[model samples]
Target: MSESVVSGLTDLLQRMRQAQREQPHPDASLRRIRLDALAALLRENRPAICEAIDADFGGRPAEETDLLELFPSLQALAHARRHLRRWMKPKRHLAGLWFLPARTLLVPRPLGVVGIIVPWNYPLFLAVGPLVDALAAGNRALVKMSEYTPRFSALFGQLVERYFPQGEVRVVNGDAGVARAFSALPFDHLLFTGSTDVGRHVMRAAAANLTPVTLELGGKSPAIIGPGARFESAVERIVYGKCVNAGQTCIAPDYVLLPRGREADFIATAQRVVARMYPQLATGGQYASIIDDAKHARLIRLRDEAVAGGAQAHALAASSPADAGRVLPPTVLTDTPEDAAVMDEEIFGPLLPLVPYDTLDEALAYVAARPHPLALYLFDNDSAVQRRVEQSQAAGGMCINDTLYHVAQHHLPFGGVGASGLGAYHGEAGFRTFSKMLPVFRQARLNGVGLLNPPYGARFRRMLDLLLRR
Candidate 1:
């Protein structure tokens, strides 16, 4: 880590901390103003933000960026703004008869300064979504953008500085070393979104300061095609979810579980769906390219390794020449070994693996054996099967007969489980995550509790007995 970068981040943290101390609680009007500023920032720079993301990714589709990043971000902001006052209000609690004239209230207070570390994938949504909660909860924040997406990072940083004061919300752009130093800073709370391996490092860094962390990490999220599922509908939705961002999404279905002897049928349906979705791979405007050559190559290698391990590889779209672009046509692998790299790691790309199972129990068992994923998809109309699978399996979130839509619902809490992630943030849950719920109890001068505070006496004994009986 560069000394200058560390010093700069430390200075920024000090400023925010000082500001938070000055105003520990921001009024609802001020919070709404900050949220409105964020909305305006997005509204005014919509085109520029899309272009910056497209430039960062060699050929990220503008429409995909809008649908996945911009839309969700604005939705989160709007939700927060609409409910800011209610969320900030102290919740009242009932006081017992014995404690008459006493009041109990739960107050939500800001956590001073918060640090948010965003990942490259869905950069805008991840950054903006968390910022909405942090700001709504009345905390000053510092965001660290991924170095991989240099164009978007720099553009976003400039926009934040232009729209908001540095003491309120600041954006920091740096490489891994800078990220390491940034994570080490003592903040009231830290939220990191990325892979599990790196989440460990972030947690370790935050540990020095004893900063509470909310890690939105990724894992091999699986999609199961129930035996009674509508095959065509399930395949279509899965294809759309997988290909939207070229399967780079953290909650994207990394693999599929199909009934025994149905692997071929599922693959054929996937191919047809992909073909219809992207008529042209080389120049199709709808299909997004991999973020860069390294990621593209990693996906290819995963497919190749699965093939070399005796798995059948099927390309959904026509193979474009390597020189054409960084687009790696969606490929499906079948009969992959359990120990294959693609199966072991969270395939954060377009490569999908199919695992056939003899029974639904087998499918559920397979999922249970691995680390809990961030999301799980089940395609079936049968309430019994849905209930069975939902109850038996453990994941951060679940969508029945759908994919990737759960995270978009502002009412739902989104995060991970075990290796997938820790702590959730969305809607009111997000506000709570960023805020501290302080319980306050006020006693009136005429309260009866004084009777029990003195030495052990007959009146105290009688009062205690009456309370215990109640």
Candidate 2:
């Protein structure tokens, strides 16, 4: 960490903190304005934002960016804007029997200053998604953009300064060294979205300040094809999830669990789906290239290691060469060893591995044994199987008969569990995550009795007896 980076971040954080102290809680109207500005920021610079991300990724379609990244961000902002009053209004609770003449309510108070550490994969969405919550909670924020997406990160830093006022929010652009220093700042709350390994470092750094963290870390999220799953439909959904963003998405299915006898069906179906979705991985606009050469090489190494360990690699889009355009064709690996790097690590690329299971119990056992994943996909239409699997297997979020759609739901809170990540933030969940919900109790002028005083007399004894009896 450079002294300049540390000093700069410290200075900025101090300014934001002082600004938050001035107005601990912004009114609903002010929050509405902030939300509108965020939406406008996206709308006004949609093309530039998309282009920067595309350039950073080498080749990511702008339309895909609109649908996947822009849509959810805008929709979530609208949701917050529409429901800001209801969310901000203090929630009342009935007084307990012991305190009959008192009132209890939960008043959400801003946590002062918030820190959002954005990842490169979905820089725009990740940054704005949490910013929506922090602003709605009426807290000033300082965001740390990922170094991997330099083009978009720098652009966002400049664009945000133009839209938002000085102290309300500021986007900081820096590399890993700067990120290390930024994480150490004493913000009231910090939300980090990235790998589990890096999450540990962030948490440790934030620990010095005792900052509350909401970590959206991605682990090996699994997709299980249940015995009664809608066969073709399930494969189609999983293919789309894995191939989108060239499988760079955090919640994209890391691997698939299928019945031992159905490997061929999955391969055939996946091939047809991939070919249809991206007719020419060689030149197709819908098909996204790998984020960069290093990521591309890493995916190949994972695949090659899996194959060397006795797995069979079946290229879904055999006609279109992956290396030709930095676009890795969707490849499904079967007979993958338990210790293969692809299976062991979170595969954040266009490599899909299928694990065969003899029974549902075995499949559930397999998933249960591993670290809790960020997301889980179940392709079962049977209500009983869905309930059993979902109940037994613990994941941050889940999608039934589909994939990746769960994260897009504004109604649902999205986050990970255990190793995958910690805490959640989206919509109302996001609002609450960034708030400190202060508990307030008011006593009526005329209460029950002043019998239970420090003086231990007959009346105090009697009052205590009555209370104990009740």
Candidate 3:
């Protein structure tokens, strides 16, 4: 790491902190200005944004940029902009019995400067989601775009610079070495979106500075298909979520838990549905690549391991040799062992392994023993079964009949618990993550409660002890 590079970014932060103290509390007008600027930047720079992401991914689909990345970001910004003023208002809190005479209010205050670390998968949404939170909380922020997406990093930096002042918001770009330096900075709050292993490193780094962190980490999320589920609908929803972005989505169904006798039916339906969704396996412009060759190879290795372990593996759609540019077929593996490599790790690709259980209780037990997942999808029409699963299992979020769509609602708070990750941000949840609830107390000018101010007489002490005890 270059000393000069570290020094330059550090100095920028120091100046921003000083400015925050010197400036007055941002009024509603300044908050609106900040959010409006971001909205305009996102709307006007859509083309450059798409191009940069496409360049980074070796020709990512343009519609995906529009539909998945840009559209959701724009909607999030709009939602935040509409509610920013209300969210910034000071909230009134009730005083307890002992403090009934005094009035209390919680003033939401920004923590000066915030740091957001973006991930390679879904870079735009990940970056903008936290950015909206920081802005809505009335704080200046610095964004560190992922180095894996170099083109998006460079282009995002330029767009941010054009829309925001260097002191207000700046995008920093570098390799992993630079990322380490960035995480080490003492930001007031830091939000990271990435793999679970990297999340631990970020949390440890933030701990040194006593910085608050919100980690949106990914684990082996599961989708369970009960015996009573509508097979066709379940297949359609699962395939749609998993096949999107070549299954690079953090919330994509990692593997599945199916009833013992239903594995064959599920696999057969999945094959038909996936084929319908992606007519051309390799060259279809609607189909996305596996991000990079390394990810492609990793999925292949997992497939090989599962097959060698006696799991039934099938690549339903066969692709031509010439069209193999980081493309993996939508695959379904059945009867995988609990200890197999596919079950042990997060399958962040289009490989869906089916682990069959004789009973639903067994499936719940298996998921409970594993690390808490970011999301869980259960396909069952039985209310009793859904309630039992909800009460027994712990996850960041759960969808009743679908996969990954829980994160899309924008009305619910999204985050992981335990090892999946910590903290949450989306809609109002984002505003709260960035703002501190500073409680203020107001008291009457009368000195009615000053009996023991200076002289601690026996009478005063006795009264205090009796009152506290009672």
Candidate 4:
């Protein structure tokens, strides 16, 4: 919070910028070295990282951190290491007849120093995920870790400093004021992963510098249970998706849309799955706690407001009592009024609302009426039903019969649209996002372009006609 600390952000950026100027384009070997160091950092400090996140969250099981965060972070490095050579290579393009004897190729160039703002929900993965892309693209990076998870953020900063050279990768940790200072820096490119409201501010600040930004924001992502869906299977998957991280995931299914009469069945299956997954319920180490008291209170307010509006609450983890840790039990609500806050806002917690529909088209229409979501889930085996939703709807990504799995596909572009967010970054999409694919054209020594360039003559007119026709 000190003035010196805030100014240090500009210092970190300037150092990275100076280093980038010294070596604008790093070779594949150097990029691989960065990947190796990052991998080693994750591999060696698994226990410490898990412990830090657990402390930050109050009590998140180590296995969940390993599966959801650590494993993905390391996997991203390996994937980048394996493909960086090819990704860095220039892509050849065929010359068109209009420009015969000329060749074209797209050369991927790094976008200098990148600024990444990481969110608290999945701090480790979000930090490393974008860093992988920036490093692979041969750019130095400055990362901002969320203040909400101070323990993990500090530990991560320490680990990064130990693994990377001073200017290659720097991690900044501070409160909102510090974050504002960090974002205000004139980074070459910026990527942020967080809520939509904050994403807007990040974009506005970046606009001052005309710095390109990639906003991975979140909205009310939904899951639709098609008429042809294996009802029980759909419930099980939805339960897993919502319950993972105790529904703290950005891409978690916010609510369920199902056929009107099947509400009881969905609730039955979901409760059963939750009980099976968490076994001990409230105090189980398998489940996670709400990030903090404020988030917990917000979720409680949403639930209270819904119930006051005539909704019925069903406790998925009803068997066990509340634990000392701030863990919120998985919950489902029914009969909530259409305009309730729960129905409108992004529910980044364990409370799942049921939005019943008479027909598949009704469900689709309901989703379309709202802001486009970061992710859409459809549970159906019928090809027609699948195609109908896939083609007619808009989402950052779609999972035919699963939830939260689309993000695991490193090959696919992971991002949102409309109110959900602004851009994508994952694997190749990420590589391109952090780079500029410059189109290089090489003309033959004896080309005829000169012939078409004259003082508005008859030959020029003829060539213009031919060009227009082609």
Candidate 5:
């Protein structure tokens, strides 16, 4: 940034802080206003957002954006707006026997300003979805759009600036240096969505401010096909999640965990599914391109590593080298050794590795051995096995018969445990994420406990003892 721009930003931030400090009770009305503005901003910029995303991807499919990104955000916005008032209501609670005359309530208080670091994979939804929570919880938001999606970031910044004031909603755009500066600020709360490695850096930076953080980080999420699983449905759902945004989603199924005797059949079914999904190979209009060349190169290297380790590789029948514009074939590998490079790292690409497991226990053991995934897919109908898997293993969330669909339900809490990430946000969870639940006990004039106030005589002691004896 130029000297003038930096000075302007510094001045603006100071002014916003002053305004927030001067507000009476953080102005819940201001929160509603910001949300209303956000709805307007999105409604107005829908076309422009689609265009910028297309420009970034050298022409992303508008229909796909509508189906996958735009429509979902609109739906989320409507749902949040409709329920914001009730979510903000003070929740009444049961008073304990000891505090008999006091009424308990959970008072929702806003954390002053929040910082949201959005990723590029699904820039539209990722940026706005969390913003919904921040606004609903009555907190001011400062957004950092990813540098990878430059066009969309620039446009989004413009929309935010035009509709909202810095004190209400602000957008910051830049490369890593600017991101570092933004993250270093002592915001009241910080929410980040990205890789596990970068999530560490964000947490470190937020620690400087002593700021609480909610990380929606991703890892090697796994999809396991059990013996009685429906191969076609399982493969289709897994492929759909992975292929969305060309396998750049944080929660996309990283690889497949195949049962021993069913590996070949699963592979064959997956190939057929891919063919049905994307008929024209690399240049298929239905398929999306990888976000950038660097990611494409990394996936290529991972594929080469698997090949070098003597795993049987099958390239998707339709991937043409000529039209490989950041395009990777929906490839699969078999006979993958436990020590293979693909097994060592998170496979954030279209390549699927099939690691055969001898039994259900072995499959559970394999997943348990790795860092807990953000989402786990268990494709079995047996209630006993499902209960066992759910009890024995830990994950951010699980989909019993499918993959990644659990996140779509606004009622569910979405986040990871252990290494996957910390904290969850979706519906009420999102509201709570940005809210401080202050416990309040409203007292009545007639307090029965006044009888024992500092007059520890024989009668008081005897009464206290009688009350304490359960």
Candidate 6:
């Protein structure tokens, strides 16, 4: 890392540590003020924020940014504001009869300075979502923006400085080397949102300091279309999920599992849905472009490799004149081999693979064989099937007859399972993740512990026996 970047990071961490030490437990009023300021930062710079993301992605749709990034950020802030007081209140627990005059309380306190690493996709929401929780939990935070999205990262850094004090919340803009150094900082807590491979490195870096971490990693999240499902509805929802943000979302349906003999029908329906959603893929501004040339090339290579392995690649829209834009037309792959590159890795783009299954058991087994995904989707009305999937399958979150909406519900705790991720953060779960729940036990003046205290004797044995029996 550059000397200037190292020096700046050191200074920022020291400032945050000092600020947190001075106010270990911020009152609800102060937390609300911080949240209000954050909301203002996002609200006042809405246009610039959208434009910067658009510039970064080459052509990111403004509406998509609003829907995917700005809306959730505002909602998270609003939810935290609404329940901050209750979340901050300590929970009282009654003591056992043996300790009649004692009381136990669980108090939530800040975890000092926190480090947040944001990914390029959904840059704004990922950054602010965790910020809401960190601020609600009364911790100073330093966010490291992804190097891939330079325009948005730089703009967000500027906005953070404009709205927040350097001590309370700061933004870091740098390359991968700086990110490595930032992750190694001895913060009280660290939260990283990105791919699983990188998550391992972040965990290793955090381990040197023994810092607690919340990893929001991604995997090959699957969408299963059950035999009893509404076929057209399932395809439509999956299309919406896959096409939005050009299927760059971490939790977007990476692939699909459909009943045997329905592959052709599903593909046709998905194509129709895509066409209707974006009448002109080449020129439509509604459809977001790939983040950059490298990502676009990667997606193309995955598709080409799958085709070379004997898979059938079908473009959603008819071919158009060649262009230099980063947009890759939504494509669906059928007959993809198990060993195909697209099937092996998390396809973080607009390419979707359709896997046919003979039975629900086979579908469930297929998912089981892979790492637990961040999100799983099922389109079945049967309560029995839902129950079976709920009990059998392991995933961070699920949606019945829907997709992508589960993460938006503030009441739900969002995170991955196993390789998908380690910890969850959303709503109150998020607040608790950032805060340390310190348990306090208070002993009253009048207690019956004297009988059990002191050297071993007949009285102590008798008292122990009575308590044990009780």
Which structure among the candidates has the greatest TM-score? 6
Compose the digit string of candidate 5's lDDT tens values, residues 191-295: 999888888999999898799999988888988888767777887888777777677777889888877877777778778888887887577656677778887
Backbone steric clashes in candidate 4, count: 0
Show the lowest summed lDDT stretch of 10 residues, model 6: 317-326
Quickly count the clashes in candidate 6. 0
Weakest 10 consecutive residues of candidate 3 by summed lDDT: 444-453
Compare the candidates by lDDT and give the number of the best one: 6
Which model, 1 or 3, shows the larger TM-score?
Answer: 1
Please provide, for model 1 over 45-151, each residue's C-alpha lDDT reduced to its tens digit, 9 standing for 90 to 100. 99999999998888888898899999999999999988888988999976878787898999999999999999998889999999999999999999999998999
CA lDDT, every model vs. true structure: 0.92, 0.91, 0.84, 0.91, 0.81, 0.92
lDDT of 4 by residue, 1-470 (tens): 68798678878788899999999999999999998999999999999999999999988999989999988888888888888999999998767887878889999999999999999999999999999999999999999999999999999999999999889998888899888888878999999899889989989999999999999998999999998999999999999999889899999999999999889988888888987888886765788888999998999999999999999999887634554567788889999998899998999999999999998888999999989999999999999989888899999999988899888888888999998888899898899999999999989887888877769899899989989996
What would the TM-scores of all predictions be? 0.98, 0.98, 0.95, 0.98, 0.94, 0.98
Those runs of model 4 whose alpha carbons end farther than 4 Å from true positions after fitting are 1-3, 319-323
TM-score of 4: 0.98
Q: Where's the lowest-lDDT run of ten residues in candidate 1?
A: 320-329
lDDT of 3: 0.84
TM-score of model 3 (CA atoms): 0.95
- Model 2 CA deviation exceeding 4 Å by range: 319-323
In candidate 2, residue 444 scores what lDDT?
82
> What are the RMSDs of all candidates, in order?
1.2, 1.2, 1.8, 1.3, 2.2, 1.0
1-470, model 2: which lDDT tens digit per residue? 66877898899999988888888889999999989999999999999999999999888999889988999999999989988999999988768988878889999999999999999899899999999998999988899999999999999999999999999999888778888988999999999999899999999999998999999999999999999998999999999999888899999999999999999999999999988888877676677888877888888899999999999999998645544668788899998988899889999988899999999999999999999999999999899999898779899999998999998888799999999999999999999999999999988888874655577988888788988997
lDDT of 6 by residue, 1-470 (tens): 77888888888899889888888888999999999999999999999999999999988889999998999999999999999999999999988778888999999999989999999999999999999999999999999999999999999999989898768999998899999999999989999999999999999999999999999999999999998899999999998999899899999999999998998898889888988888987786888889988888899999999999999999987654577388888889999989998998999999999999999999999999999999999999899999999999999999999999999998789999999999999899999999999999999888887887889899898888988897
Q: Please give the range of 10 consecutive residues that has the lowest summed lDDT in model 2.
A: 318-327
